[model samples]
Target chain A: MWYHIDPSSGTPIYRQLVEQVQQAVASGVLRAGDRLPSVRDLAVELAVNPNTVAKAYQELERAGVIETPRGKGSFIADRDHTVTEEERLRQFIEAADKLVADAYRLRIGSERAAALFAERLAEAERRRSGE
Target chain B: MSDVAIRLAGLTKRYGEKVALSAVEMVVPTGSFSALLGPNGAGKTTLIRCLTGMIRPDGGAGTVLGVPVGPGYPPTALKSRIGYVAQTQALPERMTAQELIGLCRGVQPRWNDAIVKRYLDLFALPMKQVVRQMSGGMKSQLALTLVMGGQPELLILDEPTMGLDPKNRHQYLQVLLADSIETGCTVLLSSHDLHQIERLADRATILVGGRVAVSGAIDDLKADEKRVRIAGAVEEAVVLGVEGVRRAVKEPGGWLLFVSGASEGLVERLRGLPGVTGVQVFSQSLEEIFLSYA
Candidate 1:
């Protein structure tokens, strides 16, 4: 199983599963064409309601992260050029909001937050290009 | 099949001058796994009993699987379609698992031997062991197996995993999850196991003082209800003025505002409040939310 859910977490379980699958896809742990477990199978394995698992799969499908061709099961989508610039910015802004919120909570000044964000972005870009 | 599995309106039960249930209203849709939450003496058991037809309600009416359930309404016809497991099961001590299964099969109108066999085998319950000698976990397994034999459309379970170890409890819940998925059965579970309920139940009803304090789809409840932390001293009146702010409590550094319907827009409004250095929003877990109502 590549996904685990924390029921006690503030995040809802389906959303948690959604994030886990998204993270796995981003990290290259679950590559395109990898077959994900069926909703029933995953629910049984996780001891969660099957509806919850189905909701996660539905969200993934809507996001174009996974494709479920009828009778063939669900597989990670091949997204070599599917991502739009608008979509990219939308996702980035959602993440940046959390980063900003955390920075405020930690009392980190705007300068420090900007510097840390730039440093991490440079490292991520370097790793992505195999520099 | 009707869309609703259970519907109770003005459900009231009283015991000798003491009210067990006070005009409780609840609705459980078909195929939904719902958890009934309440503190001790909060009428959880009385409500279950009323729905199961074991006890009569002084007021209100209910329907189970479209069958009317209330005073003067015998649940005889409905009983065959419902499986009930009380918190403290009263299985005959001398009867072995096989014997109980045989007895149930003889009496149940919709008994399915295969389901019983499958559940007992999956749980590895000793069929020959007498009820008195079996472990608490095994007894629970046996009780669940016998109940499943009827292929019930609605399963009413009361603290079904009370004394079992964590592993056994997980096994029991897994079987239920699979069963519900396979059959689309509606389940009304009454238990104090918030963690398990949080994972298993999609809808929840929190009862306080024999009345429903909160009830909704668990996902919606968790999404809409949140706790916001203010960095500095803030006026309670001002915090309460924010849209959807239900309650406010003072904390060490600031005020913890319990806000319902605190979606992104509402949260931004909270952040813009005066005398607030930082505003952190935390979604309340089921246990935390239940405590607020319990």
Candidate 2:
């Protein structure tokens, strides 16, 4: 899957990659054994320094979100063994907080927010199954 | 012995009575892309000239690629491995792109014909087109091909994309960034294009009014500088006195404060104040930071 980067965004590029890759794995868009793009290839595609991509991959590898198999490349790690339950929940909240804050700004309440989020999850599922 | 590709210490330059660069200093690490940013008359050109040993600094001392620089323009042997793309660079009007490449091949000791040919085709420049008839974009691509072909240890570019359309400017920046990545060449690019600098440069040194005003990693600098919008009213006097707060201006329904960092404690203090409903932090773009300094 292709990744998008906003060079002008306030978040650092490496941090953005961590979040994106985590979300992709969580959503099952990327599964265990799925290979991630090589550092040089991703950097050229994103038009950023290769060092930045390397840093992101290193962080992912450290967190056990992805592992680099010798001579092959980085691949998504098995979710159950990747991170402790507490750490996985922390990552989930970090991503969820942003979504909640956006909806809160529009005066959207929790029940409606839940419904909206469900629809989004269904939409994501549909796209993934090639419907 | 040092890995720094360029270093300036209290470098000063004067033109008759007027000063161009005044006690300016900066260091560009080897193999790093450093953007030399400034507005017009900010001594960008003067600094580049000094680094390349094309002009003598009236004071201070510096080095480029480990070689001592200048009581005056450096001799050919010292400058042989440096590639400089002058802001007002021009090609021979009667010379075709191929013929000019041939001419450079004869003089440049490190010339690589393969690179020249590769970039020429990459830019889709007509090899048979006379230099005089080429557009600004084509001419710059031509100049850059020759420069990169020589495989300089240090590549100094001054406003390399001065007069080009949006597409050409973007493409030129992409090629430049990619080349620097592939070769690990030490690059010091002088440009007013702050966005491009933010994209390609790991470090930035901003010159203002003949002095180096701000210099550091672009990421670190951007992190340290922030703009925040607080909903509801704010006492301008009270906000002004807050620690690390630089400036505060009253806007509709709120006050926009320019603060130096993303300190959570600062946000908590603002939230605790009367008439403050919410606070939103914004990271200042490179252009915004440039304008503020300039």
Judging by lDDT against the true structure, name the best candidate.
1
- CA shift at B154, candidate 2, in angstroms? 1.1
lDDT of each: 0.88, 0.83
Q: Clashes per prediction?
A: 0, 0
DockQ of predictions, in order shown:
0.74, 0.45
Superposed Cα deviation of residue B149, candidate 2 (Å): 1.2
Q: Candidate 1's residue-wise lDDT over A11-122, tens digit each?
A: 8899999999998877667878999999989998899888899999999887778999998999999864456778867878998999999999999999999999899878
For model 1, the stretches where C-alpha displacement exceeds 4 angstroms are: A81-83, A96-131, B231-238, B241-243, B268-277
Best by DockQ: 1
Among incorrect, acceptable, medium and high, the docking class of model 1 is medium
In the range B113-179, model 1's lDDT, one tens digit per residue, is 8898799789888888899999888888888999999999999999999778998888889889999
lDDT, candidate 2, B1-294, per-residue tens: 368998889999999999999998899999888989999999998888788777788998888887777654576765767899988867888889889888999888988988888898888989898988998878888888889989888899988987778777767776777788788788898887776677667789999989997898887888887888888877888887788788888889988888876688988988877888989988777788787678
